[model samples]
Target: AQSVTQPDIHITVSEGASLELRCNYSYGATPYLFWYVQSPGQGLQLLLKYFSGDTLVQGIKGFEAEFKRSQSSFNLRKPSVHWSDAAEYFCAVGYLSYNTDKLIFGTGTRLQVFP
Candidate 1:
């Protein structure tokens, strides 16, 4: 089974400060990892994804993540935080079976930005 873990349940940061959200995944083989953000009462939007390519992948909204195979981790990072970035972020691992891909998401990390 594929699973994702977001150790931080919530994080608070000041605006203009750096932010890092942690994500770890477990899978038998090379897993498809993704980061998504959801604003209040909104649907999830894909931030980035990792399938097969370079370890580092760039994403929208000034976000990026590094896929560390050895550590089984995919951590999201932003050099500076913004008030608009406050949202619930989720990390997911995808598995394919019977020609269907299912995403297993982590609990999620809620980001709060302060002035």
Candidate 2:
């Protein structure tokens, strides 16, 4: 079965510091990869995605992710962190089952930004 894993349960970073959120997926073949952010009491918002082409994909809010097939990882990164960036980050992969596509989300990584 396809699965997504976010090893980091929680992370604390000082405001203005660099941030990196790790994500790994297990699938027979490379699937559609994605990164999403969820604020408290808010729905998840798409950050970035890797469908094809370039391994490094740019996303909203100063975020970028690199898709490494060798590592089976798509790690999200930001040069600088902000207080508002604090949120639950999720790595997901789209899987096709019986011609229906569904997203399999990771456990989620909670990020806390300190001023």
Clashes within 3 Å, all models in order: 0, 0
lDDT, each prediction = 0.96, 0.96
User: What lDDT score is found at residue 28 in candidate 1?
Assistant: 94
Q: Indicate the TM-score of model 2.
A: 0.96
What lDDT, from 0 to 1, does candidate 1 have? 0.96
**Model 2 over residues 1-115: C-alpha lDDT tens digits?**
8999999999999999999999999988768999999999999999999989999999999999999999999999999998999999999999678889899999999999999
Global CA lDDT computed for model 2: 0.96
Model 2, residue 10: distance off in Å is: 0.3
Tell me the deviation in Å of residue 82 in model 2.
0.8
Q: Each model's TM-score?
A: 0.97, 0.96
* lDDT (tens digit, per residue) of candidate 1 on 20-103: 999999999998999999999999999999998899999999999999999999999999999999999999999888899899
- Candidate 1 Cα outliers beyond 4 Å, as residue runs: none
Q: Which pairs of residues clash in candidate 2, taking residues 3 or more apart in a chain or in different chains?
A: none
